[model samples]
Target: MTDDKTLGVYDEKAGDYARLMDHDTIAPTALNKFLSALPERGTVLDLGCGPGSWARYMVKAGFRVDAIDASAGMVEKASAIEGLNVWQADFSDIQDVAKYDGIWANFSLLHARRAEMPAHLARLKTALRSDGRLHLGLKEGTGEARDSLGRFYTYYTVAEIRDLLARIGLSVSDLRTGADKGLDGTVAAWFTLTAHG
Candidate 1:
């Protein structure tokens, strides 16, 4: 079942979320860096793709991009973007089986409850093509809950995230933590992993 609290937080903050992300400009650099390491012309899934910025970048890069987000408002915004296959679905509800060459989950999975992460990771694994890569960016910390903005978040320490990934059969290719100049300039932990299933 969907987490009402989490959805409520995003629903309430949808408009501000767009303004804060400024996806069109800020996403390309990271997208390019992630895409640079992938095979050309392969399918990609942009998990929690708000406003489709990363998906747009992927499409422009000549890769097919399928994207999803829990917020109807966000999905509508993303669908309006040209050349994107945007769906209003939660990551936990995704059912694609071994269909993507890359999964770019930029700043999305952190909203999931810690206990639910394994199943979500398993689903992601099932959705990837052989030798496919998965890149995820999450705020670094321990435990989970709502923030002052009423936006739900689940933070992870690097070691906790790495251990969880390994348990789900994903090999950690890269892991780093630092203050991201986004999300209101909060000191956040970020991770990038290339996993094969």
Candidate 2:
């Protein structure tokens, strides 16, 4: 289930959030790496795609992109991207099996409760086709907390994430770690892991 308060935060500040993501240098590099691991014109899901900037990039790159976000505000923005299929849906709603060649889950699954994460990852793993790529970006820390903007997050240590993915049969192939200022105006440690099943 989606957190209502987090949805409210995104709905009210969608534009600001979009602008912040637009300038993220690290994500694009990670995106490029993720893309390189996929076949040409592969199917890709921008899961929890805030504002759909990365989805827009993938669409422009000739991938069949389906972007999903829980916030209606975000769906409105992502829908504006030509050649992109986007919708509003929570993480818990995903149930596809072997449907995508690549899933860009960057920083999106972090919104799930820690207790809910293992199940979520299992669903995502089930959603991927054989040898499909899954890119995950998550904050590096412990426990759950709401940021200043009232957006909820669940943090994980690098080892914890690696183990979680391994248990679900997704092997981490590459990783990048860094800190960046988020829309909430704080720098936090985060990591992106490129995994494949």
Candidate 3:
């Protein structure tokens, strides 16, 4: 589990945090692509599902979705959404293994410390079915810390992410990077990685 102090930061800003993401557009597109590649519909886990926007979308798309987040406020918000099964848990605290067909970790794993990424990636793999697909996104660069608004973040290079996946027994099927300019003038080097066990 995340420390009490870190969870407090997210709890304080869960609403603003939900407002920051463009889930209506970005989430559907990403999820559609991920689902299209799958052989069949299966249980999906929305890892670090902030306010459960993606989880809600997945449910609407006919996929069973279980979501988890560290913030109580975020969990509360997500739990209120009809048809979403949201849990209040941190990635580091996850112990279930080989239980999901797909895991969506959009822009969330970036918050993990760089040194802790490999182990976390392995944990994700352990939570997946043998043929499970993983869709991950992260900011491109190096460093770690909270932003001005108190949300934690970390950046990664393509090579670094690829290596982590490889070491954790996931084979990278696709990787792409591009610039996404947000309203705040932050040009994020975003990437989508498709991997399988």
Predicted structure with the largest TM-score when compared to the true one: 2
Q: Write the per-residue lDDT of candidate 1 for residues 79-116, one digit (tens) a residue.
A: 88788898888887778888988899878888887888
Model 2 over residues 1-197: C-alpha lDDT tens digits?
39999999999999998999878899888999899889999999999998999999999899999999999999998889999999999888889999999999999999999999999888888899998999999999998999999999999998999999889877887888999999899999999998886
- Residue 85 in model 1: shift from native, Å? 0.6
Off by over 4 Å in 1: 23-27, 181-189
Q: Which candidate model has the greater TM-score, 1 or 2?
A: 2
lDDT of each: 0.76, 0.91, 0.78
- Which candidate comes out best when scored by lDDT? 2
Question: What is the overall TM-score of model 1 with all chains considered together?
Answer: 0.87
Worst 10 residues of 1 by lDDT: 180-189
The residue-level lDDT of candidate 2 at 26 comes to 91
lDDT of 3 by residue, 85-135 (tens): 788887887677888889999877877777788888888888888988999
